[model samples]
Target chain A: MFFDEFKSWQKELTHYSFEQVSQGDVERALGHERLDFMDFLALLSPAAKLYLEPMAQKAHRLTLQNFGKSILLFTPLYLANFCSNQCVYCSYNIKNKILRRKLSLAEVEVEGKAIAEKGLQHLLLLTGESRQASSPEYIADCTRILRPYFASLGIEVYPLETQEYRELYAAGIDTLTIYQEVYDEDIYASVHLAGPKRIHRYRLEAPERACEAGFSGVTIGALLGLGEWRKEAFFTGLHASYLQKTYPDVEIVVSAPRMRPHAGSYKPQYPITDAELVQILLAYRLFMPRGGITLSTRESAPMRDALLPLGITKLSAGSLTSVGGYAESTETGSAQFEVSDERSVEEVVAMLRSKGYQPVFCDWVNLRDRRGA
Target chain B: MQQVNCELLNDPFEIGGQKLRSRLFTGTGKFSSHELVPQIIEASGTQVVTMALRRLDWRNPQENILNYIPKGITLLPNTSGARTAEEAIRIARLAKAAGCGNWIKIEVIQDQRYLLPDNPETLIAAEQLVKEGFVVLPYMSPDLGTARRLESVGAAAVMPLGAPIGSNRGLQTRELIRILIEEISLPIIVDAGIGRPSEAAEALEMGAAAVLVNTAIATADQPLEMAHAFRLAVEAGRSAYLAGLGARRDQAEASSPLTGFLREE
Candidate 1:
């Protein structure tokens, strides 16, 4: 598992500060030569700021080369907001006194149809970390209900056992998105006060377990602002690289979800600047040129548009964080976080088209469905 | 007009149903500018030219390398920098989807220091890609077993490296490549590390179906002249191979009259 490798990498990365990276390291990283893990550290160093123009140029060229002009569009269908964990930064914490909603099979169909009407073929089903409210069987049931409308299905919920992941895979869910939230052990414990989510090792191993269960792709993320932003970014990039090398057949994606204003009053310990976030994204691109990048609507419209050419391959459009927000936006308090980009699916598609970016709704096809045995 | 080589045209070089008139395949990397690609193609008269699938830009007219490549040339889109079989397959699919064609050169390199292709992953990718209807040409280390496996998996050609990529060392693995050509029934394409025209000729003279050259022609002082020189060399080598040469001998065999007038025998 990557958790074992992550511990040694954490030790390996302890002494280096973002300021310690030199100009020569940055120059070597920017050259035509292939980059390694150490070169990746240099690109993530603070000194890389001096060469941002060249870095951005390389990132853009690399993105255009690998992904072409296609920007895969997906929308999240928040099925439930009930949680048993008291994560400080989240709005769906169990301690929070709010009306929690869980979508029934009938309601999930409505949400699926609503997203399909927007012409989205990719759907990411999300829920708060509460097994009682949103079990693996329940998520699989929802996947089967939505499978007819969408070409691809993903889950961003509580981590499950390998067997449970296999169940979801059998139900046509090909992608898994789980956020480690924070990599720092002390900070991780401090934020995740209670529930299964507090088990740090389990969350860190979720992506690998899902890959073992035969999930086609897995998106792992470290929620920015909970821990030191630079260190979090470094670990996130390293984790993605680890998963890529370990499971060569499974696709890996990384996201930098910066802290956003939620229903809670918890303040971020360290806020990453826009420039710093740009550096992180550029570093991920240069390190893993062919890896997928998911830029969510947590960022504002202008920022999202600006970062598209920088190496983002996947974009969440017309996303509804509140439970059953697509069919009916009744549970206003149930939203996990506030989305800065409130554009409709058509508007987002049009924005991509205006920039000569092709919005790909579904890049993967299910061979089983194509040729039924 | 130049004299037509009717004898050379008698036996057409074909791969995956595409008949190529020239045995010299060229690459688009290591060039100082994108505009030079078409000029080299014109000078080399190569029927097949390769480009890294990543370097192809469709939206940006200025960055689009395909705009510079003239028509009537088969585009061999290689999966460069792909560290695994899956990554190479992804690039190959994307290349075909982007209208590059059915031709793909599978290069799965995990060895960072030497940039050597992983033969195991190359074979796996070549098998999967061939099943998906691609004319897969896998570039790999020269091993007789791996070459046979590639041929069995329906690869259009087996591309064995002469040396490390971009090393400018010529025919470092000549014996291994020769074994592959002699053993496998498929077309053997010698790819990478052929820095001189003579090296390209050497491979062809040894019965290689084709030679893919990049750094030699692209990085030369006069790229067009170098490409022209390679073109002539490849033709001469092919003609020489086809015409056949005299056998090797341990002792001095006389080509002239061994009479008492010429020698005291």
Candidate 2:
């Protein structure tokens, strides 16, 4: 599998010290019209920090050339907060004493209607890593219920087998988002202890399975604060590159979400600063100019706004990370992470216009209804 | 002496049940503004325009791309992201459902380096989509055999690339395209790798039914003017082809009388 390939690249990345990434490497990377894996590594190094301005400009140009001046807008609708894992970082970890809630099918409809009212045609359904509450059948049911309301539906749930992904795809789900959390197996195992999520290989291969199951899009990411940011970024790039080469038609999105504040008192062992995050995103853009890079509400509104022109092609607006939060005013369950951008969907759209970008809501049409039509 | 005028350039062609007056088709991508697209289309006198399907904006679901396109213009929705026949068929159905009409551009490309369309997948999609009541125009590399297959599958037209898409390297496969134009019975519309108006003219001059240009016009400093230039070029090339361009000679064939020249005497 690609796990071995990924580990080999990871091992190769470890041999190069930070200082070895010289100014010459940065300039050479910037000068090339098409970037390679080495160019990506060079851009992620500390030496590339001095050339951020040129890198940002080139990334902006490349983004415009590939995706146009449009940002794909989606909002996450957290379906359930139930958990089976004792992850050190997340708020919904079973070890935490936070309240848990799972929405019924009726409640999901209400939430879907609420999101529809926001003028959003694309939605991401999220849940904690619990097979019992958020089983494949349950997720497929949710997809069926929400399929009528949204033109595009994505899920960020526990990794499933190839057949399970095919089942979800047939149920009107078009996208699957799975974060490896950290590429380093040791750090991943230490954080996600005693659960199905602890298996690194399963999660690492989930996106490929989704692609093989006929998903139009697959997103992979790493929580930045878990291990060395540069190493994590390299592995993320490698993984995304491999997937892109394998599934040439699939839209592969790479996101580097920084660890946010949750109910659990767990903090980032090696927190990635804002500047470092920007550098990492720029590296990704330089590496895969045609690939999609996503920015979520986990970052502050100001940071997200500033980074729009840099490389981000997708943005999540007006997100709520708690079960049943979209339907009712009551916060019945603890949020997985606090949303830093509290702006409404309208405000986000207005902001995008002010920056000369179009906020796209529905980028896909569901053709599975052809038989009914 | 009698007055003479060019009259052989009045021929019209039909694709997907739409009779097009102009031999030029335009695309809606890479434009600086959506509002400018209609103007460029009008200036170019193109009757068919192509666009892609993506998710609609949640904030303004009614702000559709169809609104910008003027009425009476045939909209050609392309299946650009589909790598397989199943995905292409799904997109074609969805595009028809979205009211983009039945004309579908089958572009099943899995190769990333050159962005070449997959011939087998495109053939599969064209057959299925044609059976499903669609006007399928399959894009393929300039391969005569694939062009024949697409035609046998009831493709309305065959769009063979002059070169790699967006490369602006004009007509690298001119000989192969010439072979397609000779062998294929359907309208051979030269698509992609046309960077300038002259290249578009060259394609038409070689007996192409039409030429579809996007990046050449859209990325120009003045898209409107570029569209105008392409319009004139297409017209000129069609006229030249109709007038019967003189055959090439290995040796010099002087227009003037060589034996009666005073200097030669």
- Candidate 1 residues A1-373, lDDT tens each? 7888789988887776778888977876777334667778888887887766567777777899899999999999899889999999999989998778888898888888988988899899998889999988899889888888888899999989999998888888999999999999899999999998989999999999999999999998889889987778788888998888667689999999999998788999988878778888888888889899999999999889888888999999998788887766434337888889999999999999999999999899754452111
The window of 10 residues in a row where model 2 chain A has the poorest summed lDDT is A364-373
Question: Tens-digit lDDT track for model 1 on B24-95?
Answer: 999988899998999999999898989886553556746678899999999999999899999999999999
| lDDT tens readout by residue for model 2, A142-185 | 98889888898999999999999999899989999999999998
Model 1 stretches astray by more than 4 angstroms: A329-333, A369-373, B1-265
Among these predictions, the greatest TM-score belongs to: 1
Looking at model 1, give its docking quality level.
Answer: incorrect
Which CAPRI level is candidate 2?
incorrect
lDDT of 2 by residue, B176-262 (tens): 998787557689999999999999999988889999999999999999999999999998888776654543322333333211211
Judged by lDDT against the true structure, how good is candidate 2? Answer: 0.87
In model 1 chain B, where is the ten-residue run with the lowest total lDDT? B256-265
Clashing pairs in 1: none
